[model samples]
Target: MATKTHRYRRVTPAQLQTISSLAIWIPILFAVFKLKTGDTKFRLFIIFLVFGALVDSFGMIIYYFLSNELFDYHEVFQILYLWYECLFFVWLCFFFLNFQQKIVWRNILLICFSGLFITEFILRIVISSPNDTYSSFIYSFFLVTSSFLSAFALLRIAENTGEILRYSWFWILSGIFIYCFSSFFVDMLSYTAIGRGIWSIRVLANIIQYGFFVVGLLKMNKAQ
Candidate 1:
């Protein structure tokens, strides 16, 4: 991703992004090392962590090697990965569904999230890339997902309201919520001129998200 124009700069934009990507390893490794295999919820999370890493790795390779080619393999990789991510979140939400009104709430939330994922997958099939209109849909998608996630996280924390820091589920859900909300803004601003600035913020938010994920894993181990 480095270019001649960026040669004069001390730290290129691509370099910064690459550096920030290192943060993703934290949660992945933490889960692998600290989280027990018997923990079903974290086991689901690790699946996504591994899957996302594979998708991004493949996308990066395609971009680096075949960017100038006619085929837009990289973009396809991104869209496919994003679509899977939406579904993953829905599953994640289901995994965290442990409220008092479980039967009613579970059915309702599952219906909503399933509908959203189906609609988004259909849109992805219709729209080829991150077009201007498609970007708006993506933004809205994240907004809705994040809102639901945050509400759930808050509800979970409310049970042991004072011990927020000790709740692994809260931290894990908070990280996902923050990432989704931040992604919503990133998609919102992707069409504008200040895209680079927004990209940096997104990168920073991603790094911090994984940090929160690591903390969550640690809390889970400690609570065990």
Candidate 2:
């Protein structure tokens, strides 16, 4: 859900470090190809990918160099990332609402969520903890759960239940759901001893998400 773990500023193995950095690009490359084929649906996803790449790249790598000279900028970048990620996921949830009324409610929820995000960001800085893991956990839990429910609701109302699996959005949402849901758990567990060091679940969840994304993107090609 966040770099709450500092992207494991602690991984010693070069192979794993390389793999972790590369994992995000898997979905980005697929999304880029989809956009190249003239599919506009993935355009927002493209932006999401690019933003994520920048955030993770700078936060995980560039920050290391920064620590040598300037002060570490934890409050802004990571906090901004957490806020953006939450908003994006919530908006993705909004995209799937099949009914106008449901969409309206989601809009209201979006506003509320935005306000909440702002509040959380401020709290993270004010709090004594290095990372506001608790507030972050709240965001991940709420947004991911809401998005999951939105997707589930779509499944319930879909006329062509059998064909639902063939749609690109379904798999994409499912991948996001699985990834974010796992992240929510990771955020919660981070408060305990079990959450010490780097958790493989984050890496595993990320790969699984993009794996489903590859399937989802391929389905988009087929649909065209």
Candidate 3:
């Protein structure tokens, strides 16, 4: 009797990169075509989306060129990308909060968060390895908290004023909330083998999140 053989197929980082690029760029293209030129919020959102897509593409190019020969360079690129992502989320959270609150408070909150992020970035650079679990955990925690808080604030504003379902911000916040919530644990355990194994799941979560972003952009465009 012949024995049966079983083989496992693993997903590659390059594949994840491709998936992420598609997830980010498809919505960006949709926003470009569907969104109007007015509405400051939508305009800023589109700008950020485009910038993010460009960054992702650039990272992929770097990875293709340097990953095999200069692994450290690839890692550095990834760390820089992560740092950029953190800052972008901080700005995004501030943008949402500012939309609901006073300008003075917005400025204050932005300053505070900017300081915190800078401090954390420095500490991560000084104290943690490039693949440090704690650094990823801290970044994930900040993103999750910011996303949840912004979502709650948006909900409160909607409750007092009008339908939350009708607002673009609501959908955007919902997407952030879902993405951060789903990835929180994975990020916390990012230094572990199990965490590394589940990266594809995180990519899928991001795809769903970006889908919500597209919907929000469409809704916002319709409203304008």
Best by lDDT: 3
Task: After superposing candidate 2 on the true structure, give the runs of residues whose Cα lies further than 4 Å from its correct spot.
Answer: 1-18, 36-41, 63-71, 125-133, 150-158, 222-224
Candidate lDDT (C-alpha), each? 0.66, 0.66, 0.67
The regions of model 1 sitting more than 4 angstroms off are 1-10, 35-38, 65-71, 94-131, 222-224
| lDDT per residue (tens digit) for residues 98-184 in model 3 | 444566655565566556555555554555434475467566676676667667666665765477777767788778778777887
Q: For residues 1-224, could you state the per-residue lDDT of candidate 1 as single tens digits?
A: 87656356566656666665555666888787865533665676787787777665664555566564523554455556655566666666655557577657656755665665455555554554334665566656656766576667567666646787787777887887777777676667667777646677777777777888888888875443
- Higher-ranked by lDDT: 1 or 3: 3
> For residue 25, what is the lDDT in candidate 1?
66
Q: How close to the true structure is residue 198 of candidate 3, measured as C-alpha lDDT?
A: 81
The candidate, 2 or 3, that scores higher on lDDT is 3
Clashing pairs in 3: none
